[model samples]
Target: MPEFTMSEKIYREEVHFTGRVQGVGFRYATLQVAKEFEVTGEVKNLPDGRVYLCAEGAEREVVAFREELEDRMSPFIRESEIKSDFRPSSYKSFEITR
Candidate 1:
């Protein structure tokens, strides 16, 4: 695990999850998990039956959050595509968007 300090870098990840992700409380569950971590961003259902998520925070927290979420929701997720980048933080909290 990586320890991040206020002076260290923050990372952002854009994730798209496919499978039984829609209509299965996926976004709500993701929001619940997000609250447990120090991450900020949003989760929403796409029209193509995928769940899209954007999270930004300390790199360790964001990665841990994603791992825990996947562990808890593995039964519903068939495939996940993740893209990560370095960017300035833009969200104050995590949310479930439409």
Candidate 2:
């Protein structure tokens, strides 16, 4: 097997996940996932119980993050919407907002 590396392009994205996001470890799970992708940002629960996430990382990682949310984690989430754009930040890791 040959080892290869792909350059990562960083971008910022916001995810809004609705339904059952609270009291189900959604934020914690999101933090774990973010760490896996080496993403840096924050996740929090909105007053209306929606999960809000701000993440910045490689494009591929961001996509994987969203996919994991939609597939392996969709059962925990009723619905989700994602918005992405090019933005740079100096954060090194993700966190669960208070």
Candidate 3:
């Protein structure tokens, strides 16, 4: 797969997912799912018991990533809040952050 340039990212958003998302390999699964999309981002566990993710890509790609994430993680995600218009971080690949 080709590396996605920062310049190619036109949509960026941050998501906070609540519920059983912490101990369920959420970050790792997120990284895996990310491998299928041409997006750049990071996923991490938050101290407030939510999973945080920031993804950037073309609008369609980023939105699809979010949809798939929700579909695959439906059982674990109880609530989620998505905030669009996040500042791009120039991430080269998707990752799980400590």
Question: For residues 47-92, what per-residue lDDT tens digits would candidate 2 score against the true structure?
Answer: 9879998888877787888787667677778878889876546467
- Candidate 1 lDDT over residue span 1-98, tens digit each: 76656555569999999999998899999999998999999999999999999999989999999999999999999998999987667788999988
Stronger candidate by TM-score (1 vs 2): 1
lDDT of candidates 1 onward, in order? 0.92, 0.79, 0.88
Model 2 residue runs over 4 Å out of place are: 1-9
Instruction: Tell me the alpha-carbon RMSD of every candidate.
Output: 5.2, 7.4, 5.5
| lDDT for residue 20 in candidate 1, whole number 0-100 | 96
| Model 1 lDDT, full chain set | 0.92
Candidate 3's C-alpha runs over 4 A off are 1-9, 86-89
Task: Give the distance in Å from residue 1's predicted Cα in candidate 3 to where it truly belongs.
Answer: 34
Backbone clashes in model 3, listed as residue pairs:
none
How close to the true structure is residue 16 of candidate 2, measured as C-alpha lDDT? 93
The best candidate in terms of lDDT? 1
Model 1 weakest lDDT span, ten residues long = 1-10
Tell me each candidate's TM-score.
0.90, 0.82, 0.86
lDDT of 3 by residue, 1-98 (tens): 66666574368889999999988989989999999999998999999889999998887899999999999999999988999863545687888998
